[model samples]
Target: MVETKLLMIDDEESFLATMEKRLSFRDIVVNSSSSGPEGLKILDENPDMDVVLLDVKMPEMDGIEVLRRIKAAHPLVEVIMLT
Candidate 1:
């Protein structure tokens, strides 16, 4: 059995790193980006990604905007915004 692949977007590097490590230990494939645009890029680049854990606050594009874009591009993928 394989764990789900989760893409996490957060401006806080520490949180992302820690979550990635913990999930990785549980056999999840986790990729991370620090901003919305980069997460969009991740969606474009990794279309098969199973889910996204996005932070609500960010520098450039922000979480809602990123979510809008993500939904527009890949509506079937799951997204959970962490505020």
Candidate 2:
């Protein structure tokens, strides 16, 4: 089976940690960032990443704007927004 690479972006540290742990247990490769800008940077660094689990409400940069930027730059990557 092919491994799924996922990038999780959320401002909540606990949520990120818990989800990363759970996802990692399922054979998913998980990468995470606590801010939108950092998450975008991570995406830039990891172009082969498959999907992004993004938080809708975040400081410094909101999910909508991040989604716009993501689509503008890397249209092929899939993003799932969470509130």
Candidate 3:
């Protein structure tokens, strides 16, 4: 009965909000960010995060770059890329 800790990174605010709501209902603890930098910051702050739902295309920093950074720093964290 352990709750999943998910970090969602997407440029679409609406999508993040909707996913957060739906996932919360399922007992997930969701932390959302609209940009790569912010998402990285969240990851730094929440070292216990289990998974990341990352959007492939975003401004400020692209998902690929974010993925690279995440893997470099938080290699144990799993990332699922979203189109």
Clashes counted in candidate 2 amount to: 0
Off by over 4 Å in 2: none
Q: What digit string (tens of lDDT, one per residue) describes model 2 on residues 6-82?
A: 99999999999999888887869999999999999999999888999999999999999999999898999999999
Clashes of 1: 0
Give the per-residue lDDT of model 1 (tens digit) for 21-74. Answer: 788778689999998998899889999999999999898888999999999999
Q: After superposition, how far is residue 75 of candidate 1 from its true place, in Å?
A: 0.6
TM-score of each: 0.95, 0.96, 0.97
Which pairs in model 1 have colliding backbones? Answer: none
Least accurate 10 contiguous residues by lDDT in model 1: 20-29
What order do you get sorting by lDDT, best first?
3, 2, 1
**Candidate 1 at residue 17, lDDT?**
86
Backbone clashes in model 3, listed as residue pairs: none
TM-score of candidate 1 against the unseen true structure: 0.95
The residue pairs in collision within model 2 are none
Score residue 40 of candidate 1 by CA lDDT: 92
RMSD to true structure for each model, in Å? 0.8, 0.7, 0.6
Q: Candidate 3 at residue 79, lDDT?
A: 99
Candidate 1 lDDT for residue 55: 96
Q: What would the per-residue lDDT of candidate 3 be over residues 1-83, giving only the tens digit for each residue?
A: 89999999999999998998888889799999999999999999998999999999999999999999999999999999999
